[model samples]
Target: MANSPQAKKRARQNERRFAVNKARRSRIRTFLRKVEEAIASGDQAAAAAAVTEAQPELMRGVTKGVFHKNTAARKMSRFAARVKAMGS
Candidate 1:
């Protein structure tokens, strides 16, 4: 219960922020899923392309505070490695 005006405003702001962050997270997950599907399909080129497309999205998530910096970095690193491995 937000009795104070300031608290009520904060609650409203939090709701809006939650919606935005949820959408952003969903978009990031969609990109990551594309990469996973490409990899699973055994298409190295497609997987590489998906990874290229996803890298910036992941970093954007980090910058937007949706994901932690190291979490994004680790995901990018692992995906890149997997893409590279698919080529060899």
Candidate 2:
């Protein structure tokens, strides 16, 4: 479908970017999962620690164009709220 050389190169770049973004998304999810598990287990310290670790990774995904800024912010906000509520 990419008849032009430029188009072909763009397609290749898209494929590479897609793979990288997918990996980033998966890594972010893993971090989120750690937070979730820590929260579910009712370990306030672990949940807080996981949130600390995940916030940066989520923000990194935003900076790297893997996730939208607001999306990451909302997630972090909600997760932090949940963690906070768990404490009180």
Candidate 2: lDDT over CA atoms?
A: 0.96
Candidate 2 has a TM-score of 0.97
CA lDDT, every prediction?
0.96, 0.96
* TM per candidate: 0.97, 0.97
Query: Candidate 2's residue-wise lDDT over 1-88, tens digit each?
Result: 9999999999999999999999999999999999999999999999999999999999999999999999999999999999999989
lDDT of 1 by residue, 1-88 (tens): 9999999999999999999999999999999999999999999999999999999999999999999999999999999999899888
Candidate 1, which ten residues in sequence have the lowest lDDT sum? 79-88
Backbone clashes in each candidate structure, one number apiece?
Answer: 0, 0
Name model 2 segments beyond 4 Å from true: none
Q: Which stretches of candidate 1 lie over 4 Å from their true place?
A: none
